[model samples]
Each structure stands twice: as structure tokens, then as C-alpha cells.
Target: MDNLATTWVGATAKQISRAVRRGDTTATQVVADHLEQIAISDPALTAFRVVRGGEAIVEAEKVDDQEDLANLPLAGVPVAVKENTAVAGLPTWHGSAAARTAVAEEDHEVVRRLRGAGAVVVGVTRMPEMGLWATTDGADGPTRNPWSLDRTPGGSSGGSAAAVAAGLVPIAQGNDGLGSIRIPAACCGLVGLKPGRDVIPCDLGVDNWLGLAENGILATTVADAALGFSVLAGRSPAKLTPPDRLRVGVALRSPVQGVRADEPNRDAVATAAKLLGQAGHDTVTAEPPYTTGVRIAGLLTWFAAAYREAQASGLDLKTLQPRTRRHVRLGKMAWNRGWVRQEQRDAWRAKSLAFFEEKNIDVLLTPALATTPPPADGHSGGSWRHNLIENIRYAPYAGPWNIAGLPAIVVPIGLRPDGLPVGVQFVGKPDSELLLLSIAGVLEVANPWTRHAFV
Candidate 1:
């Protein structure tokens, strides 16, 4: 029953909610169709590490009967959860052999919210061992791009990004700590957003290092991303909607170290800016003091926490994927600080606040990554580093927002010359996600991206 394929396939969150209200579709059909798609594609793409056929059907059956579920915001929508997030009765493998047999006894907050909203969780997507390197399936040796089975899907949330981009589901969950969500979104050609720290309670992630990570989503459309953000945020009922006026910031310098902007990425950002301008908002292109040194410092801080966690968990650092282990090990080292690291962090915060104060800009815009898509397959030792350093340049655009505990959004402006998609991120101040979402809704109407990259 291709409830998702032919039915409101491109339908926004509002449309899906309405369809469920009208009983034109039931949560069971939506979950079933997506489950069917996963059954077919998982073997070829290896996008998902685990598929929950029985659990999804059971939840959907409940939605099918309950009138309350039909009226719920996400009544019949089907979604994928990243494996790292716990789902009661499912294995919460942080993508490692250690947790291979460790099924979660309770649902993670993210999963709880999704179920509470009546969304059917059809499956849990793949991740690198504990989300170490952007190693989506490099750990399991299965993760690859749906577009080109040979390319990498961008780590951590790569499975989620790939699942949605492939249209297996309209949207899927992703966790971003150091560009995990955005990186996969960029590579898979989907919309991804990282909310401000504390915007969503991360019960398992106890890191004090602000920038190393946060949770977000990958969706076929910006609205799907918005709905996912809305539900997961657990915003107090007092905040019903995002504000109307949002302050937006534009970055003049690249956040990656020693790297200049790539043509496709720049073109994409320019396209998004033009859309922002047409939408009748003030825009500026000044260097926002966002820097790579700050990135290194933040990574170190994150590694300190991750290392402590690894030691406590008694997980073998060596058993982890090489890239993830290498980076996490590097995180245990000394800080690469001076005037630059501290200054970037401080100045960016001030710049963010002033951007809103002076220009009434509440959100910032930039590329998730500075390059076009890469091969879906994992890269080798040194070549991987060079590729990551060059191709994944400017990931900081999304990172700074996470550090500031601000929310960020990305939707495709359009695709590049090579037929791969290029995207720009919209970042909102802390708790201003509702406003950022409304802004995204405006752009969505202006330029809608149909998940047309693959057949």
C-alpha cells in the first residue's frame, strides 16, 4: 500500500497530520510501506543496520485503532531511528561489538517522544562504533550511499541520512556531534538539522564538550525536519510556535583550517542566501569569528568525555573502527590553544548575540560541509584524512550553533553540476527553533526539493 510513495509522498508535516485526521491513511500502512521499502533496499544499500518489522507493525496496529493516535500530530508517519538511540525491546548498539547483545531496557528520550507523537519507528539505522568517526557502516562494513553503493554515507547518522534520501522513509532520526547529521545529509542529499545543546535532552550523551555533538534529523523535506525537531525538542507547552522574526547570520570565512570554499558549496550557499533575500529578510556576509582552532579545542573537549566514557564502559578502543579510534585517541591529547581558540569561541557567541540584537537576525546560514558529495564507500588511512580535510571543510558552520546551544536547519537549495545535491544550513538562537522552522516553511514553498536524486 504505498501509503508513503504515491500518497502524500512530498506532503509536509501539516499535510501528513491532516491525512491521518481524515483517515485517508493509517499509521500501519505508512509503517508497512516503509518497512517494505527497507526490506527491498537494505540488502542493496546496506543503509540500515537493523530493521524492526515486528515492533513497527505492533505500534502501527495500536495507531490504527486508537482515535487519539489519528488526531495526534504524526499519526501515521513512518520514521527510522539511529541505532544509538535506545528503543525498549531493541538493541541499542552504539555500533559496536560491545553492545551487539545489549538491548535497551527503556526507550531513549528521542524514541519516547516519537512514539508519544504517534510516529511509527520502523527501524534503527546504522552508525560507526559508538559514532567515533563519520563511520556510518565502516564499523559493520555495510554502510554505503544509496545513490552510489560505492560512496560513503557520512558517519554516525549516515544510515538515517541514507534511509530518508533513498525515500525508504520520508524522514529518519540522526545525531550530530561534530557534523554527523549534516555530513550525512550533505552526502546523501537530504535536509538535516542540529538543535541547540539542551534543546533535546541527551540522556546517554553526558559530554560537557559542547561542540562534539547533539541530536538532529534527516528528512526528505525541510518541513519533515521541522516536525522532527519540534517533537524531539520537548519544548515546554508554553512555547507553542517559533517566533516570526528570526535573526540570520552569514559567515565570511571558512570554518575549516587552511581550506578555501569549494565552488559547488559556495554556489549552494549563494542560492540559499538569494532565497533568504527574496523572503524579505536582512542578510550580511561578514566573518563571524568562527574558526578551526575552536573546532580542534571542542573536539579535544569531546574526546576527553568520550575517552572517559569508553574507559568506564570497558570498551576496547582498538576494537573500534580505525578512523573513529584514531580520532577519539587524538581527542585524549593536549589542547591546541592560544589566543585564537578562546577568542573564536567567545567572539562567535558575541557575534551571534549581536547579529540578533543589531539586525534582528535570529538564525545563521552556512554550508553543512564545504564540498559536494563524496564516494559512498569509506576512505583509506591517509587518503581518508586528506579527503575529509579537503572535502569536509567548513563543517564548523553547524558545529558553532551546537556549541552555542542554538538550533540549525538545512534544506537543499538545488543539486550541483555532477547531479549531487548541495545544501545550506539555517541556524536559530537557543529555543528559537519554532521561528527557524517557520522561516524554513517559507523557503520550502519558494523552492521545494523533491527527493529526486534517486529513482
Candidate 2:
């Protein structure tokens, strides 16, 4: 895989599996090819924190020997998991040294499903500490954007996005508690989908707020993301979510996030909204109840989670990257839970559902990232400062959906002048991840964005 790697990076799991099933390509060959590519390309890319080379080969061989149709859908696909996920033999560190010693005892439910479906787990990608930041600026360091070596790939899920974008893997699993998945997708020119919480079972009993993030796939095509959903979606991982009549709601953000419909992001989402309307779905440009208050209210949950982590472990808060340190400070300050604020946020959630129910709005559409792609050199804030603001201003929409525990899919719709990507999000009702993925496939067919390579 070279510049030619673009074709394979964008290959859907379905394509890889079909090749393996037909004996056109052995799973061993496919996994080896990606491993070789990773060897040559991943050093500067800095996309992985854990490389499971030998371990992955053993698993890929299982695919080669597998004759049963039980794992038919993803037999030869090479995938990367965010370092935060436990993959049996591999360690699941939340990108922190404190976790370095805690090797995983077993596969996380998400990892288990991917393995059960026969996707090869090549390695674990990088992320910010505890997924606290939107940019992948970890205490460990930043992961570069594949589209431009000097730019960021976007964070928490940054390395996963970079790996998939750089053609290291066909798909990489990403979790978005904040805008982790979409941020990188926008930065790297890929498709990212964050489904409703627990639409897939999380074996560990994580706190509800921090659990806002859900594991999803970052791929070059919507179908690739759809394929992951088929192989590794829901509690047991189901086949492709069927497409159906989906009513779409449009939430143009309030003026506070610093941009609007006049902006490219706004236009991209509006265009998507119009396309949905033209597709015979109902589309309305409106606001959910706590529309104006989401930014402030949502921060409560994000900060609370960060605060708890820091206090519980005394997280060496000072040692964290500056912006993250500041977040820990802010989180510590919010010891008081504002039920009124939560009530408003919850009311917005209820209102959103009532509207969805009334208008039969099965899905909602909005900007994946509030602003355009950040400069390739990354945000202008001090590493910590930039990390903080980038998370807030650029990623205003994704978290609200996360807080609501609703499913959302981000599909790349267009590219920026710098050759970066921009995406629109589709928010669905709770547990509607399958429905969201199916709709993403429809929109993906309506507009495909891929084959981008940095080298």
C-alpha cells in the first residue's frame, strides 16, 4: 500500500470480507499489508500508542482458517481500537501512565463483538487523557493529522481518526463523549458516527455522564461505518441497520457558538437538511428547548466527569497538559450539581423527543463541528488553551446528543479549502443507532467523500 493505499483505506469491511470469503485475498495478507504500512508510515503519524503486531497476526490467521459463516461479515478487515478500549491481551490505558500497569483482563464488549465478527485488531490508537479534550493533545502528546503532517487529526479519538485516514486500517473504533469522533473526521476527511449510548453493551458500569461516549467507527465511506455497525453494533452487533422513512429535524445552533447558517458549516448542514427534504423526508429548521443553554449546561456533565477523575486519583492535575489542567480545575469547582440546569437540559431532551414524535422526526441534522477545520498547525491556544477552546467552539453540537444518550452519525459532506473534511451530524432517538447508521448509508450514497491520502 502506497499512494495506492488510498483505495484500500477506503475499502469497506464488506469488500474485504467478500475478498477473503472468495479466497481472493487471505486475511493474513490483508493484515500483513496494513502492518507493513504501519511500520513504514506510523512513526511520523504517531497514531498509535499500542501496536499489537504479533497478537494481530495470530487473530488474522484465525480469519484465514475460519470456514464458518459465523464471522462472515468482517473476516479480513483490519481495524484499530482507541487505546482506551480493553482488547484482551492488550492494555487499555486511558492515555495515562497510571494505567500503564493495568493490562486488560478481557475484551471490552465492543472489542469482543469486533473480534466475534472476525475483524483483526491491529493496535490501539492515541487519545487525550481520559478523553478529556476534543483535540488528541494527550499528556502523552499530540497525534498529527494525516491530511497534513503539521495539522492535528482532532482528539480524544484523534489517533483512531488519523490511523484510518492514513490508510493504516480500513476502520478504527472511536468513542465520542465530546466531539472526539466528528472532530477527527472533520480534520482528516473521513466519516465518523457516534451512536446512542449503550446501543452497544458496555460491560463495565461506568458513570452515566462519562458514559456519554459510545464506540463507533471512523471510515472513508459511510458504508464502511455501516459495515462496522453490522459487524459490531448494538449489544450483540447486528447486520446493517435497515433504512426507512426518517423524519429529520434541523437545529441551527444559537449565535453563542460563534457561527451560523452563513458559515460554511451552517451551509453544509443546511444543504444536508435540504437534501433530506428533497428526499421526501420532513425537514424543519428549529430549536430544541434548551437550545440557547446547551453549551453552558452540557459543560456541567463534561466538567463533572473530569473533576471526579482528577479528585479520585489526585490525577497529578498539574502534570496534565495546560488546558486539561484548567479543565480539572473547572471540574473541581463544579462540585455543586445544578438540578435546575439539568432539568432544563433534560427538558430540552424531552422537548426534542416530543418534536421528533410529533413531526415523526426520526432523526435530527446539524453541523458536526461548529466551525471549519482548525488550521493544520492546530489551534492557536497554548497547547492546553487551544485544546480547551477547540473542544468548545468547534464541537458545540455532538455533546448535547451525547448527554441525551441519543445516537448520532457524522458523514463527511464536503471539503474545506485546505483539503480537510467537514461533516454534518444526524441525531436520532435513544437506541436508534441502527436507524441512524442506515440513514447515514442513504446519505453516503447520496454524497460520497473518500480516497484522500496525505503522502
Clashes of each: 19, 5
Cα lDDT of model 2 by residue, 1-455, tens digit: 35443344446677887888888888888888788788878888889998889889998998888667444677878999998778887666776665343677888888888888788999999887777776665444567887777777887788999998888898888887767787788778777887776665543224644566677778887667777765556334346644655667788864245644337778788768766666667777656555556666677667777777666545676556566667767776775544224575566567667867776667778777776555444432266566656566666666777767677778778776656677788878887767777776666767766645644
**How many clashes would you count in candidate 1?**
19
Prediction 1 global C-alpha lDDT = 0.67
Alpha carbon lDDT of residue 410, candidate 1?
A: 71
**Alpha-carbon TM-score of each model against the true structure:** 0.86, 0.89
Q: Give the TM-score of candidate 1.
A: 0.86
**Which window of 10 residues has the lowest lDDT sum in candidate 1?**
236-245
lDDT string for model 1 (238-291, tens) is 233333444466764566566665788887777777777877766776455555
Cα miss at 285, model 2 (Å)?
1.9
Backbone clash total, candidate 2: 5
Model 1, residue 411: distance off in Å is: 1.8
